[model samples]
Target: MPLLRTNTADKFIVDRRKTHRNSDVSRAVKHTRDRLSQRSGSPAFDRELLKLHARAIVTGASAIPLLVLVIAAAGLLGGMGGTILSWALVTVTCYTGIALFARSIDKADTARIELAATKRNFLILHSLSGLCWAYLASLGCGECQVEQFPVIKAVVLLLAMAATAIIASSLRGALVATFAAPVIVYGVVGARYWMPVEATMIGLLAISLPFFAYVAGHLNRSALMLLSFRREKDGLIAELETAKSMSDEARRRAEEANLAKSRFLASMSHELRTPLNAILGFSEVMSNEVLGQIQNTTYKEYARDIHDSGRHLLDLINEILDLSRIEAGRYQLNEEPVSLLDVVEECCHLMELRARNKDLRIVQQFEASLPRLFADERAIRQIALNLISNAVKFTPAGGEIVVKVGWTAGGGQYVSVADDGPGIPPDEIPVVLSAFGQGSIAIKSAEQGTGLGLPIVQGLLAMHGGEFQLNSKLREGTEAIAIFPRGRVMEDMPALPTLPLRAVASGGRRR
Candidate 1:
């Protein structure tokens, strides 16, 4: 049980550590939202369904103007036949982008959302394509005879494409690729295609390089900070919830213990008062002869019975007080030389009278050669009395109760009380020794009991340098054993003779 408890505790600590280390709720929710929102076209889709398809058709149609120019450039470069191949490559690339955009409308596409990064990448590629457009348009090419469109339109398109790329992505490699645009614009607006505007445009794009880097670095740090705060807040919320649950469980356990304690206090008070009330009032009455007592023979017997009941209640209270002291670590033992046989004989004799009332017999067996055990005399006597009394209390009419004493060859004495009665059940064997516990068979057959008899015996045994053990079987019998160590085994062993029968309190009798 201890090992299992330790393993469970270790696992809980490991799990709790993970709970603090990991981001739990909000991060997971945010990630899921990112997955859902990243899909659907344009990175800005108001009505994802209608605009998704319309955007695809529009982007595909728009690619044809650039594709036609690229093919015209290829015809000039590869000498006529390569136009068809260039158009086919442009068609394929356009259709692929269209397919990705179209896929985002049907359902959330995690793969297609990643393809949005491809779209970002295409911006740099488009910037390079714009540089080509500017170069080809600058020449009086076969397809377009308009030379004015190259200087004005081509340079404008190249700068716009480069600026579009800077807005789309922060990746240094891709953004730097847009530098091709300024070079192409410089050539188109220069003297052959002749304009002074291209030099000023190159100077502006050169200044924008450091500006782009500064902006990208700032946004990256900001995004990293946001993610870190999200993880911290999520962990804190999980910890707070765990602490709340622990507090609730502790409060619930305390409430249950309090209820049980209240019931116990009430029961003990009622039980103790019943005998004490008679002892206080009647002892006073009999002493004063208020009822003209001491005349009839029955009067003496009644007084004796009341006195005995009160003393019995006092003994019970003392046992309870002793248990409280032990729990508080305040109980101390006074050691003396005690005979196991003498205490056993006395408990048997006291129980004999009680047992006879139920038509039960009490028996005692002692070894003549039994060695004396060093123990606390008062505590040992109480242990014997508690065990024998419980046996007599639970046994049926005509049942036999026996007390036995013997010595171990290894220098210990054993005292045992056995009864022929309905014994404890298997399930409740350990519980039979606990405070305020009784076995299933004991409760089933007996009417009234406080369930503290064996517990008192156990406490008294512990006070000595001894131990008490209980062994029982259902419907068979029970054997309660107390084993004491003699001589060298005793701690705090004071030199004193065994406590005689006369020295016991008036509650317990000795023959």
Candidate 2:
């Protein structure tokens, strides 16, 4: 009978062990599913989430030593009984192992591990820690006569649960496992005692569980939101970087194309000029009858027309080349102290004949006390000529074209050309300022030009530390002002010497 009983007991123990293992496996599968269902994007995010809980596990390990000290001080286990001390030591050793495992996860190369495996390992370690804490709770204070000793034990259990809920809250599975095990053990001990105070304490602990779980859920959501926002910010920054890279490449290509165009024009300069010279010379000879008189009068008129057309085309080519050189940074200015008044007067005189031919009057206004401008003489003359020419060309027959040179309020000088012509529209100002972009009035007028004038003026003034402004109103008039900045204006004058220093010295010596 004894041998039969022994065999039966062995079979029962084996069955119980198999049942426990199966239950653990089922619980683990359920835990993994619950945790993964709320997974956010990115494997890196999951790794970070798991690492946070792992840190909590390590942090909670500190509670074991504190519990041992508390039990020793209070004599809760009858002056630290051998069984209780051994259990405490076992708990401490297990927790230390858990803490080291967590540290390894933190220090391990994240690149080598799969995301799913990392989470599984962390969860496994956490569940094992919860089991250890649960075992501590199950160590009933049955030997203690003091009723308050159970309360102390209860307090320690609840404190451990609270720590887990607060720290590992970002991962729900870890939070639930770490706290639930201790809670169940506490309930079992409370039921065995069946005292009013113990029941009341157990009820309070149970009620606190749901509240902490809710807090855990809320914390998890907040962390997920923050991670999402970080991902979005990173994506936006990457997109902006890519767009900037593309823009820089396009700009580089555009500059290369422009440079090639400039080089081609510079190389073909002689070829273009040779044919133009032949056209002009041959047309002039035919028109003048230098070799022989043309019998037909119509042929002589056509020859004159050809000569004029050739000269206009040649002038257009020269203007294009000059503007190209300026844009290419190859145009060198011959700087000097130039009389602004003289340059304006000469340009006005040159354009006066054109104004008179179109039945327009030229009006000049000069400030007598204007100072000399330190600038490129050729550039200043070109600036004045272009303005005066545009004013004369656009002004209506019998209209007045006013040219003014004066001192600015800031001790600088200015040249303005105002014409009584159809003005440019405000919206078209940018269009007119661009290269080869003509205005509506210019296109309709008989004196339409290549539209390079304003851009050239703007470029030239930029080189001189000056600015060009155009003010106009439809059907009223147009005024173009070129302003030289105060820095370029010669304000302080050097005192003139009555005689050379050497001459004065020689005269003094002779005396």
Candidate 3:
């Protein structure tokens, strides 16, 4: 067991040394790969890199004066005049370089060549600055009085190394060079003039060198990752903007096409109605044999078929025109005080014959106290007519449909049409409400329609600040409701009294 322990200890020591050695070279290799492989080719990236270095230079320039004061106070300057001159030269050069580089990056466009040159110049400046700090830390201690505190000198040197590690961390190459140059220079000097206590401290400093490099490498990697993420976000935003522009263009074209179609339909209304009226008139006469008796009974039957088909076609055309007018925003309403009962009763009466034809029953429930509505009379008629028509059409043979007109709990009036038919699926409610969209059951039923009824109802109600709702479940039934807002409800007014005839005559004579 002891032999196994010794072998394990030896392996651990070797692995640790290997890690340290790899860390020393890892900074340079990783930095080279990061720059060469992930070259963003963005001018903004280059500009940002320049700005980071400029900030570091400016920060280092600020610390120079404070560092000089501390060293002078500690009596660690080997030659005070020489040390002060060197600090002034380095500080002035660093500040000047910072200003010039920052302005250059701002004013000049950054190309590939310019970016490479900037990186090279920055690395050189950072290396020279590191050498100056090394000189101050190593040779500056030559004239330190033996009585002066050694801890102060050590503190100043370590602090300078730590600050460099932090300040130059944005660029991996610059960070490694800045820290390594000073440490390597100092290590050589310390080896040349070694003492018992100082040698131990120097050895410790050497051991910590690789750790600082590793930290700077991690910082650089994090910065690159952040930049990459930002670039991707910007690209995504650009793509969304392009998509929005294309969508807007497509929508505009669709509107133009719809407008053209509406205009064509409106123009053709006169042409269509004139021939249709003539055909309906002539066909009805022939079927009834009003002018003369028909020799062949088949002629009368054919005339009846022609008349029915023409009437149905005319109804479909009228519906298409009405929907077009509503869609084009040209359907104007003449508002008036209208009785809801009158409109609903008239529609139910007109649809009664059609309901009887299909052997379906329509039940009418009207609230006697339901208030009048201030709305377009013709529009109300159309709304009721369309709802009753749909109910009668969808309700199965021998099925019942209910048409209800009453005041809602919210003090508004509503018209509801419910039928026992193959109801719409919940998901198809929206589809049925859309223009020219019908439910699957309605499509498969023998009586197919143009499918514009519900949408027309919805649009008209919307114009009156009202709402439309469709509630249904498959294989059960469907109820469509059209509600008017409270504002549209017309309150009842008291009737004015009339005076007696004799009193009115006496009053006129007195006047």
Candidate 4:
């Protein structure tokens, strides 16, 4: 019974886990979709985007200083030495300030971040960086004749614009804020030169600025998508943790209830039996007139009725206790070698008078030469008694019951009791097998029962490593079979060959 309870609890946990997992996934998906709908231009999204931008800035801070050094070296080779070197110093200082600001923002708590004020400050700093780049772009190499300087300046501006687009992509307008001034300054200065190379550089800057901005916008959307996926994952993990906690709570409650039931039954066994025994004993004495003859016939009849009721109540109590013990895995078996045929025959004989009173016939069929089964004798007797009594109780007057004990095809033994009673519906079979559960037919029958008989029989059979099956149709009778496995069938062993006593004595003398 404990095993059955554990299995039932495990099944429920598995089913509930699947159900909750599906619900959690659906809820997470719906929540993500709703957030996505309101994502663009929302204050909450802006704060998150700012945080991403800060993290990106801090991560690439080292690379920015290296790129500035390389650009400074290239400008010196082109003979734009002093002006280019001064711009590099200012650029590095500006980058250092931006990196420190971003680091502070990244280290601050998320809830404390003011999106509007922080975004305004970030754009102002980026514009300063853009003015530095503009200064570098407008620098001219007048001392040396370097025709490739225009190409070098254009390439440097383009690389810087692309880098800004990538690093500040999470913030919506950071790319435009950084490069818009540089593009304008470069185009204005190049138009002054009026040469083919400068004109081409101006046109390229004009086109590439908007292109990089568009690329940055796309990257920002990708970051939002990535954030949504991460939120959903965190939500799922939280849901699973909640489900596990609920499952543990449910199992704990079930265990507590089971323990309370066992304790109640344990206490009830003595509390109910003591009074019932007194009732039965006194009622029997009054009904039989053991002490003195009862003068009133009505009083005697009343005493007899009391005795019968008490006996029935006692039987019900016993059956309940037996079932409780079996379910709690406390029913101990006193195993012995016993004959299945003899057990069934004794049960039929005990139930014979009850069947006779109802004018029912119980036909017993036994297979001869059956082996003794190694099982609990009392449990086997109870199994046989329960089956036979159920048949006699339910079988209609003049209806015939067939009791058969025979070998199974697997060399095991089985006791089958079939009755021509009002049959149970197929759907109610499981209900009938449960403790304290009765089918409609059993409820409507003239003799009502506590409904623990078949359950007790099944429990006993399970203890013996056996099986119980009930077959019935609506109009046809019900057949109950209790099968003992082949392992429980004690087969006879062959005798060993004997040697002569004189030869043993002669061998002992020689030794």
Off by over 4 Å in 3: 1-79, 94-111, 114-121, 141-167, 184-219, 422-431, 439-445, 472-477, 493-511
The weakest ten consecutive residues by lDDT in model 2 span 1-10
Regions of model 4 farther than 4 Å from truth: 1-38, 73-80, 139-163, 183-215, 233-257, 333-342, 365-375, 404-415, 461-467, 483-497, 500-511
Q: Which ten residues in a row have the lowest lDDT in candidate 1?
A: 1-10
- lDDT by residue (tens digit), candidate 1, 1-511: 0000101111011334444534665575566455444422334332332333234334444454454555556555544445444544554464455445444433555334444454454454545544444453344434534444434444444444444343433233334454455444455445463345545545444565556646645543444344445545655576578768988999899889866765675588678778687786787577557778587768766776677667666666766666655544566777666666787787787777778889998877888855456667777787788888888877888899888887654466777788988987755655666666777767777645666677666666656655666777667787887766565244444778867666765437543
Clashes of 2: 0
Task: Order the candidates by TM-score, highest first.
Answer: 4, 2, 3, 1
Better candidate by TM-score, 2 or 4: 4
The positional error of residue 233 in candidate 4, measured at the CA in angstroms, is: 4.5
lDDT of 2 by residue, 177-203 (tens): 666777788789879978888887788
lDDT of each: 0.58, 0.76, 0.73, 0.85
**335: Cα error in model 2, Å:** 2.5
In model 2, the runs with Cα more than 4 Å from the true position are: 1-125, 140-155, 191-204, 492-494, 497-511
Candidate 4 residue 399 C-alpha distance from true site, Å: 2.1
Best candidate per lDDT, number? 4
* Candidate that beats the other on TM-score, 3 or 4, i.e. the better one: 4
* TM-score for each of the candidates: 0.43, 0.77, 0.73, 0.79
